[model samples]
Target: MEAVVSLDARGQILLPKEVREKAGLRPGDKLAVITHVHGEEVAYIMLIPARKLAESLRQFLGPLLRELLGPEESEGQGGAGPG
Candidate 1:
């Protein structure tokens, strides 16, 4: 999907409705912009939701913590490992 938007005087660009809908972005939602370098070629832009990223991190780190600290550790530590 491609979208073209103009930056306002305040240096804010409004995302197109279609692009926002496709990306599941909504008003007041947080976005993380990622830029990639490719040997001086065209850079890549990635937009990710902050909440989604946090959720993904939690999901991935849960089992890793369990493996390192044992499954019972979470229970013994007052469920602080992942909640």
Candidate 2:
């Protein structure tokens, strides 16, 4: 989807109604804004629902943590290893 929205005087831009509805956003829902910077300038911006971001992080990190900690340690035998 492509959209061009103008930033209001308050430094806020309103998402198009179609965009909001398609993203399943509700009035009070939270969004996580992600940005990519290139050579001191922001090149791109993205948004993901906060809950979705947390779920994605958990899915990705849980297995990696389990592997790093080893099976026995992953079962709650200890805390994080040396950095």
Each candidate: what lDDT? 0.79, 0.83
Residues 1-83, candidate 1: write the lDDT tens digits.
49777879998898888888988888999998878989997587777899998888777877777778887885575334444
Where does the lowest 10-residue lDDT sum fall in candidate 1? 74-83
**lDDT for each residue of candidate 2 in 1-83, tens digit (9 for 90 to 100):** 46899989999989999999888999989999999999999998998999999888877876787789886686584433445
Q: How many clashing residue pairs, candidate 2?
A: 0
After superposition, the stretches of candidate 1 with alpha carbons farther than 4 Å from their true spots are: 40-42, 75-83
Identify the leading candidate in terms of lDDT: 2
Show pairs that collide, candidate 2. Answer: none
